[model samples]
Target: MLYLWIKAFHIVFIAAWFAGLFYLPRILVNLAEVPPDSVAERARLIGMAQRLLRFATVLAIPALGLGAWLWLGIGIGKGPGNGWLHAKLALVLLVIGYHHGCGVLLRKFVQGLPTHSPRWYRCFNEVSVLLFAAIVVLVVVKPF
Candidate 1:
């Protein structure tokens, strides 16, 4: 029962996290092209993007925690020996790193660190999208 409940929660959170991951980069794609003259609109765009990131984090952390429990606590004691699981963990770590990078950028933005530069943000967006897509593939396909 506990395992089932945890799995449900994990699935819900993972779904939300992946949705944000998929849309964030696309948002950045438009943000990169938005003109500076539209200050209010730009702020709205940035705000929405930041909120999505925050939402993703809130969902992902718990999901990953539950997943860890399902793996290490409920599942077998296997480590990195299983190629599919190993690849999944690697991709998960990459996603976590990407999440942390977003957090760093969030802090910088909050601190008024001149975050309007679309170049760096766009680059980060590209990296985030790639890493997230890779993680999704690893999870779905479990390819070695």
Candidate 2:
């Protein structure tokens, strides 16, 4: 019962976190494309990016915490035939890495030194979708 509740919240928070993950890069895309002369627009976009990143970080804590509780505290899926969990964890790490990458890019943008083109950012935005799809498969199918 407790495990089920934890898992439910974990899923909820993860979904929320992914929402930020999906949108943040798009915001970066907009930021990258902002007209250089539009100082007000640039400032607005930067502010939006900063707030979204912080909100995403907040969402991530509970998602990760609930995930840890389910895995380490409850031991809900930590036994034989559970290789899928390991794979899922690896992908989760990649998602975290992607999250960190977003922060790095955000910092670069905030400094007015963004190096990536809008096209590059557009491509990067799809990364979360691919990772999310793979993660869903690992969790639901548990194919191992």
**Local distance difference test, each candidate:** 0.73, 0.94
* Global local distance difference test of model 2: 0.94
Task: State residue 26's C-alpha deviation in candidate 1, in Å.
Answer: 2.0
lDDT of 1 by residue, 1-144 (tens): 998998889888877887887777556656656775877776877798799888888888898999899889888327554576777787788888877766666555445465546676667777766766776676667665
> lDDT tens string, model 2, 1-144?
888899999999999999999999999999889888999998998899899999999999999999999889998676789999999999999999999999999999888784689999999999999999999999999998
Error of 2 at 144 (Å): 0.6
Off by over 4 Å in 1: 76-81, 104-144
Lowest lDDT sum, 10 consecutive residues, model 2, at: 108-117
Query: Where is model 2 more than 4 Å wrong at Cα?
Result: none
Q: TM-score for every candidate vs. truth?
A: 0.73, 0.97
Clashes of 2: 0
